[model samples]
Target: MSSRPLEPKDPGLSFGGGARAVLPLTIAVAGFGISYGVLARSAGFPPLAAVVMSATTFAGSAQFASASILEGGGAVASAVTAAVLLNARYGPIGVTVAPVIEGGFWRRFLIAQLVVDESWAIAHRGDGRFDLRRLIGAGLVLYAAWTSSTAVGALGGEFLGDPNVLGLDAAFPALFLALLWPQLRNARAIAAALLGAGIASTLIPVAPPGVPIVAASVACLVGLRR
Candidate 1:
């Protein structure tokens, strides 16, 4: 009798692998959280309010966009709109990993909270597979770092003064680059990445805050043709 083929082990998921994988970026995450706190404070968010936002929202770009609009005297509706638009990318991201997440409605709902850019990328196991354990682990650590740092920045906003002076703005970009570097493995991957970058660059000047990122991601559809 022929034996069944052995199953491949999940690359990561056990023993807090996901959490450890994302730890190196803790500093960057903290910097970004702090930057957001400062911006939120500058936008008139009270210290408790900013920390609560970080804890609850857990979305970096969306928070920043909303805070910026509020700072610019935009109405609450406008600020909420900006935030929703910036976070729209997660709709696609959520679908991508839906299959790997184990459990029913409530469990899944809670798990979904951890699916941020950093955790998603860190937990990705290539060929469209993701490790839920790693994702959860990374998300938990990142959440702690973000919420705590936001508290620090919010309370110390007066002393921190200008976030730009501390060069905190570079944190997210640098973290993105680090996450993206490992994915540029082949000609097709490189081409897709370059195309996405080109599209984003073209749209940045002409489009709204979140438009370029969402627009550029359309380039990834090129793979569907293959």
Candidate 2:
């Protein structure tokens, strides 16, 4: 027998399977994007500004934070600060996902640009058998959903009444709870969330708009380490 080691085999899924994956992702993203758009509009932002944010920033939480800062007469520095803090989670995400990406510089760059929490979660859920095609498909579909929603929101924002009156602001928390509920199978996770919430409540009165989120995230990290 030759001395060469055996190479692992890959299950190359069919195109139909890939489409099945992309469809649900697209629908979810589009719905989230719509909510984001309505919120941006209700916050008194121009439609163009929202679209630009969806295009450049690409992170929903960061974009919303930046928009709030901007609309509140905050300076550009404040917007950047809020966005950076809110989006700090993406850095860790990138670290873990770096190996999954395989491509030339430009392709990798595009993929990185599309690496939000949703895409990362979807990619990881693919059972370690994904390829460039799947990643690209998921990313592009999400991007399209986000951008399309922003556009729709922007268009509607101009002619529409206030979105906040309809409790649009609470959408984020609801989304978070929806995501968190499924992950609460363990005691540690629940404890961490409660600790983080306590920290946030204590800090909210004294801290700035985006600072409580940072503090809570830190608290969660520390709680996890304990």
**What TM-score goes with each of the models?**
0.85, 0.62
Please report how far candidate 2 places residue 134 from its true position, in Å.
3.4
> What TM-score quantifies how close candidate 2 is to the native fold?
0.62
User: lDDT tens string, model 1, 91-160?
Assistant: 8889988998878999999999989998987777655677788789999999999999899888884565
Predicted candidate 2 versus true structure: per-residue lDDT over 1-226, tens digit per residue: 1112112332323223333455655655555566668777767777887888899889877887877676677898988887887777666567667786777999778788977765554344222233444455656777888898888877773455455566655654554555455555666767777877898899779876556655776644644364
Instruction: Output the TM-score of candidate 1.
Output: 0.85
- Regions of model 2 farther than 4 Å from truth: 1-19, 38-45, 125-132, 157-226
